[model samples]
Target: MTIAEAPPRLAAAADASLRWYPGGPYDLARTLGPLLRGNSDPSFSVQGGVIWNAFTTAEGPATVRFNPAGGAGLEPWVDVQAWGPGAGAAIESVPRLLGAQDDWHGFDEPAFHATLPRMVREARRRSLALRLPSSGRVVDQLLPIILEQKVTVIEARRAYRYLLHRYGSPAPQAGSLAPAGLVLAPTAAQWLQVPSWEWHRAGVGPQRSATVMRALRSAVALERLAGLPALEAATKMQAIPGIGIWTAAEVVQRTHGCPDSISVGDYHLAAYVGAALTGQRTDDAGMLRLLAPWQGHRQRVVRMIQSSGFRKPTFGPRMTIQDHRRH
Candidate 1:
């Protein structure tokens, strides 16, 4: 598509200070430029100036072609899309959350930009998206993230890949499945219909499976939670029995892009922050203490540190993945 003409669909924040490029698998580097780093997904493809892919969400089907350097007069890419109804809204919000809307806070800004180069290199190496994806609703997002909770990264990625390959739908486009065998994850309604045997086959245990089912029961309401205040939305999410602080924070950090949601219970975050700031491993309390100065943007600071290259020692034995089916 020609860069001179603005895409038929585009989203800008209330202040016009921020704009977004839509379509699936948006270009974080081209869209947000130097502000945010992108972790490439080897599964997607690039043709011409667009990255084409389909994102399967609970809201029917959406096929997106992401064109970087989009929008009118702006050299940097803004999100552009054609068919997805909620796509514009989700894409628009990401830039604002990435600080494309407001100038950075003094305390947080100093730390965020100060440590940014290191963070970008580190995030690129690890593929961490500080601004996570919000395709349509996040209830479905919670399921896959919960699958990774308290587990090794390899195990989590394996489980996600297996489940999607087995249960999800192929792209609506005839052969756009890409890189051979990639399938989108099962939607919320589809998740509800999964057989008990399939859950076992996918290596999901009773607790995690039950949590997904419990959340799916109110999927519509969960999507509506997007409009609630961050803490209130998180509280509503936590009320779902199995959804706890970490899970809720993880979901909201993307859905609301709440500046302060530090994911209080993450496995490596506390120690990562502790070692980065004080040169020693620290727990939740220490993480809070170190991050207290950047109260409004604690998560942003943590994001910067995480993007920094310093890694905590991984000497401890990895968490073992148990096949509950055998139990």
Candidate 2:
């Protein structure tokens, strides 16, 4: 049968299900995994082949469950169901949010392929289904990312968990999809109301908290960035004092699925990319030089490198994981 005429595939056994045929290759895990900040992230959960992602949309809180149909292979289809007052909008956002809308045309061009190492090329071939998912919610992405700035991942995760448990609302259909206490992100106003003491208790320091407060003050303006170009959105985000290149890149990667927004100021990324591409570890300038050729698709190159499982040599002292909650 022609692509458009393919038979409908069932994703879930439930009654309120919606099926989506991507037609092209799609890997649900590779595309959506980055959005999951941590395994313990209360906003996202995966169990029994189902991905439960909860978020606050313009309408209200939504919990979207994704079930991949067929098997683990190219061109897999997905079954989606959303619950909450914003179910319709959330369901409609499934395709964009899951990277079904991502295009991979120029990535495999002869010139581009010639530049990739054998390992990276093989990874690209194996992961053709990898697409960047755009959640279309800047705040949802921004909050967690802010907490991650200049902190150990464990510390950031603990702070995120604490904050969500304290202020986050119950996700729609939490009983069915998420862990018992799973919750959606706090509303914009709620973010503003987060007191100084609570910030300290959550292990979030003044700088990051101040950044969040600034973003929340202009939450409406920031949310409108979903409609702007990725470059433009990142620029606007950087206008805030604490939100710099690294933070902006993190936000746009999920908010716009921006292919070119590489984290220029990331602590480990420059060294990792430099070591992976060249033989030696390099600074941000060297990494940028190496990645300059893939200007429009720099982030794509980074993702390919990441998927290739290449690791840089580690010889320095690792960042200590501290718990500010005890103090």
Candidate 3:
């Protein structure tokens, strides 16, 4: 069924509460697992069986809670609840957010399937319920990804935590989700007003902070990219200064659920894919050549390979954590 045909109860309720059952195989945890930065992500909290995510939509700040409604099964449904001014929009987004629009039926091809190792094939079979979540919001994903540029995960996450704590508003129903505070991301205006000192305190360097400001200045145009296809959306995003292929790939993976957008400049992805598939280290070009056959489903293939628990041999020094704040 189309999005327009979604349950009337969902759109009608401004308070935003609805029960949804995905007709096909679905795993809420596996599908949305990547969206969460880590268990410590201040914007998201998973407790017991429920996942709570707080974000600022065009309408306003909102908090969404996803609870499993049925017993453990391949096709279990979820009971969704939303709060705050953007509740209606958030509720309307449930279907896409839960991956209702991801079409993976034609994803697995003969050549790609034939190339997979037994372990990877088995992993793929077990994760058939996993789907790519589409947030349909650019700024929500873009800012954090920009913060991640040229920084360690720990540094990036620290900056995100600090910025949200300092500038974000409290999520309306965050108390129910966790005892700790859950906050929505800062709005465009708020992001623009953040002092350079604050950015430094948050461990964000001048370069990354400037990048965010540039995107915020064009926030309206950037948000419009959500309606575009993944490639086009990436292209539009790359037009901004400091936003490159890696940043664009990261953004579309969450915003559009683009399965083909690969992180071309990743430090370890090419090596990992190369080591797993060819038992050798490969650069981005080699990785692209290897993944050519699985063009449309390249990210899906990468995720499967990652889930297969294969790791590349570490032969060199790791990237050291840098503290720009001190500088």
* TM, every model: 0.72, 0.91, 0.91
Itemize residue pairs with steric clashes in candidate 1. Answer: 20-79, 21-78, 21-79, 22-79, 22-80, 69-77, 70-77, 119-307, 119-308
Model 3 local distance difference test score: 0.82
Q: Cα lDDT of all candidates, in order?
A: 0.57, 0.80, 0.82
lDDT of 2 by residue, 1-327 (tens): 011212244324222346677677767887888898888888888886788887877777787778776755545678777677777678767778887657677877887779877656776887776889899899889999999999888888899898988999888763344556668889889988889999999988888888889989989999999999999999998888899999999999998998889998787888888777776888889998988887888898898778667788994778887666567
**Candidate 1: residue 293 Cα off by (Å):** 0.9
| Pairs of colliding residues, candidate 3 | none
Q: Considering summed lDDT, which 10 consecutive residues are worst modelled in model 3?
A: 2-11
- Alpha-carbon RMSD to native, per candidate: 7.0, 3.0, 3.0
After TM-score superposition, the amount by which residue 259's alpha carbon in candidate 2 deviates from its true location, in angstroms, is: 0.7
lDDT of 1 by residue, 211-283 (tens): 8889999888898897787778888888888889998887776666566787887877887787777678888
lDDT of 3 by residue, 200-302 (tens): 9888999999999999999999999999999999998999999999999989988888889999999888988888777888999999998887779888778
Q: Where does model 1 exceed 4 Å of error? A: 1-53, 56-59, 70-74, 79-136, 174-182
State the displacement of the C-alpha of residue 284, model 3, in Å, after optimal TM-score superposition. 0.5
